[model samples]
Structure formats: structure tokens, C-alpha cells
Target: MDAAYVFAVRFRLDPDRGVAVEPETFETRLRRPADDPGESGWLFFRDNLWRGDLADAESFRGLTADALGVLVESVEYRALETDREYYDALREAIAADLAPFNADSVDEVVSKYLGSSVEIRR
Candidate 1:
């Protein structure tokens, strides 16, 4: 019963790019306990998300206990797709939730994740 943590955070770019979806969103995929069904596949959705793999719910709770004092405004979390249905379940859920907010088409999601931008990387 493999598990992972997904984080969705909202950030504001110093120089506005005229994009409607704020600055940029970052998602962190991390491995976690396999038997912890209580809080398996935790997904953090927040203004400034801070999520990662932890031993137990207590560990996860402790991480967010203190504010990092950045531009972060809020944080949200939930048990995402479990190991059994992780394949399509998590992928579909992410698409469905991010489709409306993404600036580019759904097909480009992967490319965007890889940091493929109009400006070529040297």
C-alpha cells in the first residue's frame, strides 16, 4: 500500500506575466508510509503549500505547526488516491482540478512540469 503526498501551492511572481492563474503553482510528489491508511496519499491544497512524506499524522501535523513566513497565505490537505487505484485515480483527479486553473491546455501540463518555456533554456 504505497502512499505519496501531493502539494498544490499558489505563488506570486515578482514581475507579473499577465497570466490569470497567479504567479505559478508547484506540486511535490513524495513517497510515504505504505500501511498508514489513516492519512495515506495526503494532498495539500493551499496558498503556500508545504507537503512531503512523513512517518505519521503527528509528523505531518508538526511540519505545518509553524509558519515559514514567506508569501504563503494558507494550507489545505486530504488523503489523495491510495496505492491500489493510484494509477489513473490520482492522474484524473489532478487534471480535473487543475484544468480550469491552468493557463495552457491540458495536453501541455506535462511539458509545463518539465519547465519547457517559450524562452529556450541554454
Candidate 2:
């Protein structure tokens, strides 16, 4: 149940910055542990996502731009790829954590944040 939150980032660099810049697009992913559903600090999606997309594109773009030191043109969410085993555990964890989020159910929480972006891989 290996998992990651994938994104496609389009950015441009200024040649006048006095450095050779290559690649206009970058593919980045934040990996998640497959076995540790209750791991501390595992709220990546809950913190950064909303309604199947980024909670704040402008702020995310700013962060990405700052990280890369470039002008970010756009950011696209790809998917959260994982297996069934981990997904089930994630649901359980989400259920346990639902109180703080003021959510009714795990499915609601998942749908609110992930929507159709979750891909189950064998």
C-alpha cells in the first residue's frame, strides 16, 4: 500500500537571474507511510487539501515558487496513489480523527478532501 500525493507543477525561471535553469515542469510527490495510519503528523491532506484540490492555490503556488525560486505558472493535482490495504486503514484513522475535523463520517471526510483523486494500485 505504498502511497503518495502527486502534483504537476509548471514554473518558469528568469535567465536574468544569472543561472542556467532547466525544465519548465516539475513532478513532485509527498510519500505517505503504508502501515502507519495513526502516525503523528500524518495530516498532510487534511491540512493542504479541500474539496479534492488544494485548499489555497495562491498560497501553495507561493510556497512552491519560494521553494524553487521561480515563477510558478500553475499547479495541478494528479492523484493519491495507494493500495486497498492502506486505504482501509486510512479510513479507519480518518474515522477516529473525525471529531476534530467536525465531520460526520470517514467517507464524508475522504470525499471532501480526496474526491475522485484516489487511485488504488495493486
lDDT of each: 0.36, 0.75
lDDT by residue (48-120, candidate 2, tens digit) is 8887898888888888788778788777666788888878888888887688666899888888888789999
| Local lDDT at 73 for model 2 | 78
* Candidates in order: C-alpha RMSD to true structure: 15.5, 3.2
TM-score of each: 0.26, 0.78
How does model 2 score by TM-score? 0.78
Model 1 per-residue lDDT at 10? 34
Q: How many clashes in each candidate?
A: 0, 0
Model 1 TM-score on a 0 to 1 scale: 0.26
**lDDT (Cα, tens digit) per residue for candidate 1, span 9-36:** 3332334576465434433333323234
Q: What would you estimate as the lDDT of candidate 1?
A: 0.36
